[model samples]
Target: MYIEKIQSPANLKQLDLKALKVVADETRKAVLNRVSKHGGHVGPNLGFVEATVALHYVFNTPTDKLVFDVSHQSYPHKVLTGRVSGFLGDMEAMDAVSGYSSPTECPEYDNFEVGHTSTSVSLATGLQKARDIRGTKENIVVVIGDGSLSGGEAFEGMDEASELGTGIIIIVNDNEMSIAENHGGIYKNLRALRESKGTCEHNWFKAWGFEYKYLEEGNDVEKLIEVFRSVKDTDKPTIVHIHTEKGHGFAPAVENKEAWHYSMPFNVENGSSLEGPEHESYDQLLSDWMLQEMKKDKTLIAVTSGTPTAAGFTAEKRKQAGKQHVDVGIAEEQAAAMVSGMAKGGLRPVWTVVSTFLQRAYDQIAQDLCINSNPAVINVTGGGVLWMNDITHICLFDIPMLCSIPNLIYLAPTTCEEYFAMLRWAILQDKKPIAIRIPTNGVNHTTEAVDAAYGYEPKYKMVHRGSKVAIIAAGSFYQKGENVVRLLADKGIDATLINPRYLNAVDADTLDSLMTDHQLVVTLEDGCKDGGFGERIASYYGPTEMKVLVGGVKKDLYDRFDLQQLLSDNRLLDEQIVEDVMRSL
Candidate 1:
């Protein structure tokens, strides 16, 4: 009821401690309702409810820039900042608000449109610096999770914020968990601080030249307000390390924090998933395959950058892998470089990362791994246009981002047979740093045997050899190409269907061969068109007479897009492709 009354962060300041506590309770219910209706970050938002309420009570908000790192935990903040309808209303109403913190949603309150982890501190530091430059004295607060502290940029931001020699508040929300259980040495220090109730002699925040203050009652709104009020606009940079429970309000999320970190639509009463059982996935397949291989090879390592579940390495599988499984916290850059070192030390290291997070490790991947030619296997899951419609977490750009890196072989696998074979070949081969873009479009299996030495050379497999029009589909788009082929056949146009598995390498011979019979070559890739697989194909046939139609999402940031509509807009659908081909003819 109080949550509905809240129009902005300004409204929270008007509420007393008892009233604020009521608001926090209402906010938690709103978060649970929204997440249960659709699917969203459940634990992080639930955990930060009280803290967010206390923050609005103490600070000036838009005047006092509040930056949330990753901003997955900003649901409560949104609920308070005139966006309660999205949470309280029907599933259709939820569309009004993004899952992450976005300035576009509420420019007055939400400072940044952040989805990735460990960026709050750095972003806040920049805002603080800009404020100082403009002769402003508004309090700049950064709410970062304990898990985010492991990121390289978080440390970079802390160092700069401390040296700023001005007012900046960095609130480290210590839930003692990242996406899963916390990893890295930083967590140990955090644990010490939490155990000692901030009385620890060697404080990580203090070590970084920050005036550190720890709050034991992080969830208590009155206490949070008291602590926040103490450091409203201090002259020096400070760290307000607050110990909070992840998934605080929700029973199921509280018990199993990892599983509830991000939940699919689930039953509100029992917290069981509302959706049916998951179909066979690449993630489960990879985990099953890796566990089997790890038994044979003692030196095999499965590395993850905080998101272990992304790689299908659940807590049980992680325990089974034991010392062989490594979670480098939420540090993708570190994971990228560390895997390279593991490879250099004669260890077979396979790092699985979500495609969205992979962009953070571009420099490390190019410099540390590719430049040295380390034999590291990087499996990039969630490639192409994903169900995660947030603009900050778009999976459409991985093609260009990874493919551009020299000495890095980016392979796109259309089927389980091809993916496993590529994974096997990548692990065994010690020549270059290879990345497999695991197919996002539902699991597919073929009775045909995949060549063991399929990926060694730059080549494209001709699936259906026909004349005039050629459909060179890469990765997830191969199935779409197959559909287009059938549709084209219906129209008496027998289109040539080719599966280009390797993303980086252009099979000059196969492409040249296509030129003989195919007048029009349509390159279909489930990624951005610019600088992607299709562009490479288009570039290859630039000097030739063959016309190349690059089919992929256009170069632009699509916010909370409909996947089917995105494909339709790009003319990537079967009927759309057929229509385009007919028009071209």
Candidate 2:
């Protein structure tokens, strides 16, 4: 259709308003076609299709930089910018492109390799400053969502961007939702602005030194182009707040906005998931346990930084928990500090976070939570080497960053029983700030009795005790240690398998015991080897006669990679570990 004919912004500029509207329609279809077959962000892209189309039509892109915040909403932008083949072509073509914006893929149009939220304004300000320094005058436009404004960095960017006193247009795409429902006090002002059709008396932007404009019909192609054209090459820093539906065109996504924010492979005809029903997960287990605990104790609360669903607190479940469940919007720093405050106030707070997002709150976690020794339970999901291969979302670095912090006990549970046992202990004990790395591997259960006092008495559990070779595997990699033990047995070498439940510290007593029978100790962790769980083991046995071999991912940034190839390359496979043990022996 119209999308096929248009290759670039130059091609889009040739089309009139009518043709532009037709192209927006076609772009939406292409997005649906691609995302329906291959899983991706659905609501964000569906909502921003018109804005992307209008921006490309109005501006001289690549020359006039257009920076997208998060870049999950850049799918429609991708379809129009000489990459429609990825969306409209075969499965191979779809697999070629990543879900998030990548500079490597399209250096000209996609300004940054972004997957995280609330960074566009800061990034664009840098671009504008550089251009100004070079005596060039290319318009720098930043497209950021209303939910992103809650982040500390976004506020910092806006504050600094206003002081520039030059031409910079910040487009606030008010979709009225983050990954889930919006939170924080900033959203209340956004609601007021939306209700008053941008004529709100109390405008946060105006107070922050920004020339403000508003658009009620954000989905209208001609209207968006007109507003975009008005702000083009302006002398003052400006904010164009545009209100749009989150899942505008799709009925299911429009109705259930949060659930459809990011979709698995789904049926296009009726928005049913093609990936089938979700099985039992650690998130679900945690949600159930938390609800049970919250019922018994009124002061217990569940906290999240925008991604409540990651903790299995769906909208329905959230309503059930009521005020007990807190979403701090896309602000992890605030979540960390607030959870610490909650703990200091004697309220039991469990802050659940994804591994990659935890990077933002490192300072707060160290200074506020750990330093204060706040009695808070931080449940870390997606902590290990994950299936998410995007460079921005890689989870291999959390171990090094987190485990180094003092007064924090990071526990790694291998099974569901052990996980719940650790969680139960972390919640009840008001001693120190404890973070549990929720296992990323498939949900596993153990028939063996799990000690209730596991975290309290931090020690390694020896599963299969034998001879000269010892394998101390942490968390999900404990399963890998089991397979490696079997492989070693096949080679006529009986190996000792140990599960080091805690990541932050080494079990000195267990290691001293291992020295009696074991000579070569192989530490396997589902994370980066350098400064990781394995390194702790290596450091522990440094002065001893025992030899230590650390098995983990190499220290490097990877993007959209094959999981099997990554494991094989890193020697994370059971066979690889067995081979390494053989060589060491």
Candidate 3:
């Protein structure tokens, strides 16, 4: 009811402390209801609801820069800034708003397409610098979680902001987890600070030249406003470390921090998931599989970038794994470098992380790991295209980009069965570091032949090989290719389908052999278009006159990435593919 009266940030300006507290409570209920219905991020969003509301209430948004560090906490930002209704209005427009902030979907968003963490400080610094150069004066706020404090980029931003003496309010939303708890040295300090009642000795912020302050209670809107008002415009850079419970309002979420980090539609009554029988997530599967695999090979090691919890390896499991499981906190760059060290010591290493988070470690992957040709397995889960609103840079497209780098092979498995095959292949593989891009499909592969598909089906096998139209399918788009093939078969127009499992290899021999028979190779992948599967094929052909059609996300990031619109844009409709084939013939 409080949410209904508040239309915009302007309306929030009219509310007093009591009214603000009421609004925060209402927003929490709205969030609980939605994730209870359609499912989404919980702790991170719930933790930041009041902070986000207070920031909006205090500073002028659409003008004042508020770049979110890992934007997963931006659900409340979305709720207050024009998008409050749809996803939060009730259950009607449940799918209307995204789980992350996007400048493309709404006018309120002011930073890069999000999903990756620890870059908000740097992004805000850039905005601040630009504002200074343009002679514009507006408040620039970068709210970074303490988990992000371990990341080198956040430190660099803080150091730079300190030197610039720019007044950027870096709100350290210290709930202690980016997603599924945190790790590394800085986290220890955060815990120390929390335990000492905000009086920690070794100040990382002060070291970075940032004026530091701490707040204990996050839900007290009045206190939050007081802090913001007091620290609004000082001459130098500052970080306000606020300690808040992950799920502040809700009871179960407040306790079950790990399980409730992100939920699949749950029942609001007791916070039990409504989405279902709660099958093991891909992360859990990898954990169990790794545990089994590691028992035999004592030389095996697991690496994660502050996300072992998401990877389903409990602290106990990780401790049991001993030196095997390495948690580099939020420092992905450091994690990649450490992985290279593990490989150097003749250890079989596997780095598992959310897809979008991989972008931060590209340099290390290419330079330290891949260039040296280390024997490591990088498991990529939560494929980016599947969760587009997060604006995660790493996804299906990273396969091709990383594939482009020599000695770095990428195995894209559509199902769990294929994943095991790929895993075995990567383990035996010694020459180069391989990254397996995981697909976002529920375990539907009942076919015993599914395991066979990984190897027996040929790394690049063609289906319905007949005439001019050919679909070069890579990754999870194989299903779409199958559908297109069937549609073509129904129309008496045969559509050739090829699965390029080993994306880096390209199977030039197969393509050259097929291109002689078929006219066009329309490559379909579920990712960004520029460096996606299609472009890779076209690039392989070079100026040899292979007029190829490539389809995926265009360029800019959109919160609501319509797969249908992308298909239409690339003229990739089944009928269109058939028509193009017919026209060519």
Candidate 4:
């Protein structure tokens, strides 16, 4: 096969347009085979196969750097860069490479380890500046999607790139979708440009001073090569806008682009999921609750930053929401600030986002929401150690980042009852900006139904009271605390077990009271130890006689770590906690 012969982009350079098309076909099959078995970004890889192949054939990559916006669309790029074996060979081979582009795996091929969207233009601009400084004339290209263009960072970078007046090729891949359908006014202009065949006076790229070129047939390798050849070795900033199908060459993905954007292991023949039925998730619960609440309150709104599916807001639910559902495509910063405005305007705004993505809006949370004291409910879903072991998507840092922000109440709920109660309180209370870290594991109803009317009092709930030792657990780690309590009881050491629901602030009164009977106070959190819930508790008891032991993952980037092994390494096991307490005593 042509794909097997392609060891690198250098090999791709040797191939003609016809041979390149053959390689693209082979790459698409490999992507489909690997993605269907192991699960990955199916539609993006399939859509961008020809574009990727054409770019590698025309550009001298590794010298002429190429950066992908989200890197979810980098599967085709990986195949061309001597990594086809990972996709085409064995099932285990797919595990050898990450879903996103990683410099660690192949420094020569992948320039950045990017998972977030709208970052390529900014990243590639930096590379261009660095090359200019080094007196190098190599090209710098950034491939960004239409959906990602809605982000503020992309505009900021594009604005700067226009002024540079150097050789920078900005390829705008207009696939007409993000993870879901594209949102924002920019998409409207994109549609106009597509309809007018790039002759529209309201040219978004041209307004930014970029020399614009558009291709009607983006999936055509010959057309893409012609477009690339026009801008090759040019000494001016240019944008090559190519209109391509999102899920090209795949009928199922093309018909339902959003659902096929990313998928679990599926039956290749029918495109049906191979995994069993999905359990009821916190996302679904939040969505259902919001729908019910919206019926009661007209001013209630559900907000998401491009990723509506993450919050379980299906297209049907979004349609039902009508004017109440707000999707500010790929703009987390805007979403945070907008929700703050909505709260100030006497509206109940609930902004649900993935924990990792919310990090981008830290400044917005601190300045726009917390400083103004807006009663906005930010539901941080996927806030702990996730099974998906990618460094860029890790949800560990949310606890530390959110907790440090002043006037922002960060709550950790262990069970569905607590989560619902916290959500209810946050939505109803007009006191301060609140963020609730949604439980990651399956639903556990250990505790009774929480009182919705009860105001948040920054107090830890004592599950079991005992003398000598007190174990304080945060959110999902509460189960571990219960297990430790059981193990302590078996050893005749009846320890006190406490669940510190409020992660940001300490319940000083309750903690001080524990000092009378408890000799040791142990704090456990399913996040980074540095600046996390455990550290706050440790600081609270610093001057006191009570010894504090903080148990959590270390302050480091944990890449694809086994969750159980990570817990054991941190001495979070029941036996280990019991042994440590015994030794301290």
Q: Would you list the clashing residue pairs of candidate 2? A: none
TM-score between model 1 and native: 0.98
Model 1 C-alpha lDDT per residue in residues 428-471, reported as the tens digit of each score: 99899999999998899999888786555688888889999999
Off by over 4 Å in 2: 455-457
TM-score of 3: 0.87
lDDT of each: 0.90, 0.90, 0.75, 0.89
Candidate 4, which segments miss by more than 4 Å at Cα? 454-457
Residue-by-residue lDDT tens digits, candidate 3, 1-585:
768666678889988888888888888877777778877888888998889888988888778878887776887777777776755656657676667667766756546666667788888888888888898878889888877777898778877888888788889888876665676777777788778766778877777888888899876788898888888766578889898878888888888787788788777899865654667567778788888888889888888888786577886778777777778888778888887788888888888877767777889888998878887888877664555443454354566467667777777776677777787777665767878887775553535443332332235755457776787776667776777778778878676777677766667677787767676777777777776667778888876766677766565645444657656776666677657655655
Per-residue C-alpha lDDT of model 2 across residues 1-585, encoded as one tens digit per residue: 888877788999888888888898899999999999988999999999999999998999979999999987999999988899889999999988888888899998888998899899999899989988998989999999988888999998998899998889999999999999899898889999989998989999999999999999999998999999999999889999999889889999999999899988899999987886689998888888899889999989999999998899999899999999999999999999999999999999999999999999999999999999989999988976765778899998889999899889999999999999988888889889999999999899999998797554568888888999998888988888888988999999899989888888988898999888888999999988988988888888999999999999999988877888999999888788887888888
Please state the error at residue 108 of candidate 3 in Å.
5.8
Please provide TM-scores, in order, for all candidate models, with all chains considered together: 0.98, 0.98, 0.87, 0.98
Model 3 lDDT, residue 487, Cα: 78
